[model samples]
Target: MFCDLIRGAAEVSICYEDATAIAFLDIQPVNPGHVLVVPREHYEVLQDIPKAVGAHLYQVATKLIPLVQTASNATDMNIVVNSGAAAGQNVMHYHIHLIPRKEGDGFDVPLPFPGSVMPNRQQLDAMAARIGSMLRDPLQNDGMKLG
Candidate 1:
């Protein structure tokens, strides 16, 4: 569907659009101005998207923040992107959610790394080391590629 919206095959109330990306209202909006932005090209996983396009997504989201906030009278913003199924990415197509927020809205964005307990400093360092080793080429994460 996002591809359909971008292609004009599916009817969508697009709020913004350009050669590289597009923004539109979410059907199941967390708030009235909740919007979703997506790259013009279809990509399921973050690793598969080019850096330029990924950067463009953030640019578009940043650009939309104030506009959406003003429109919805939102006091805060929740910008989110879930990369994989384990990360809560329901839609395979890559996208970003721009949820408008207000005080006592009764919604809380889940922690990025939710778990039972916090890790100690030593454990944190080990975790960072494990991921830092893969920073050189995140797309090829030693058989951990999402796509």
Candidate 2:
């Protein structure tokens, strides 16, 4: 769907464009002037995008933050990248949403979940160690199991 927008087949109110990426107003915005920055090349997932292209996407988004915020008269902004289907990503092609925020605008992101529990210190250590081990070496196991 986004590829169509990039190819000029579908209509888009483009705010920014370059060889690697394109930024346009979202068809259905969380707030007015919400912009979506996307890579020109089709990438199904965020990890599939090359490091340079991924970095470029963010760099462009950062540059656009002030523009969208000013246009929307927003007090703040939320730059969101819903990476996968499980993470509320409706679109398969990875894109970043630069949403302008205003005080009492009532546009809430569903970040808080009901009945979430805090982990103990040991659980936190074990989780961190697992992630750290994976970063250092994918195959190496810290052998710190948790329930």
Candidate 3:
């Protein structure tokens, strides 16, 4: 699906394109001129994308923000990335939403879990430590394991 869009096989209007990625107007836009930035190469999730390509995707997204705001006459914008199926990512391929915002636009960006309270500092700290450890060693084992 994404490949077709990038190759101009689809009727979607193209907003911008480069060697690494493409930005196109959203068919069902939150506001007029809303856009989606997608990498040329398909990645099922953000973590699956190479760091360089991921960074380029974000760079393209940043470039679109001003264009969307100016074209839609929006006061603000929201760049959203739903990483996984559990995060409301309908498409398997990675894409970033460039939603333009205006006063009383009536588009609400609800939290993943509404009315959730913050945990205590101690609990937060402990969780962060565990996550940090995972980042330092994803398998929870020293970097001795091979593919």
Candidate 4:
């Protein structure tokens, strides 16, 4: 279904396709020749994806990076993933962004804040330590095993 939507769209120029993945242009692109690399499976997010599928997706992306750069004539690019709704993921299917960037492209990624109050480094470290301890404790028994 997802592949159909991508392939059917007129705006997206397909750069590559394989059994496991497809690379196509982004309709609402951040830059010229912005591409979306998606797995053939319909997994919603990275955490839900099986390791083998995830590896395949990464391999596809790696293979297409140079092709996208050459085709778009871009010196550099940004690869991004928005895993959930809160993270600006409009689609439920898993996809990786490949945005071609050039000098003075008149694009600016929004930062969280302009020199806003930042979290204390020491406090963050302490919180991480506490979380690590809780995660290591067998009593918690959360289904997630961080081996």
> Lowest lDDT 10-mer window, candidate 4?
3-12
TM-score of each model, paired residue for residue: 0.86, 0.90, 0.88, 0.79
Q: Which is the better candidate, 1 or 4, if ranked by TM-score?
A: 1
lDDT of each: 0.90, 0.89, 0.86, 0.83
Error of 2 at 10 (Å): 1.0
Model 3 CA deviation exceeding 4 Å by range: 111-113, 138-147
TM-score of 3: 0.88
What lDDT tens digits, residue by residue, belong to model 2 across residues 38-146?
Answer: 9999998887888789999999999999989888899899999888999889989899999999888888776566566888999999999988777667355434344
Residue-by-residue lDDT tens digits, candidate 4, 29-58:
988889998887788988888888888888
| Quality of model 2 by C-alpha lDDT | 0.89
- Model 1 bad stretches (over 4 Å): 110-115, 136-147
Give per-candidate clash totals.
0, 0, 0, 0
Q: What is the C-alpha lDDT profile of model 1 across 82-118, one tens digit per residue?
A: 9999989998999999999999998897666476598
Error of 2 at 140 (Å): 8.1
TM-score between model 4 and native: 0.79
Rank by TM-score (best first): 2, 3, 1, 4
Error of 3 at 72 (Å): 0.9
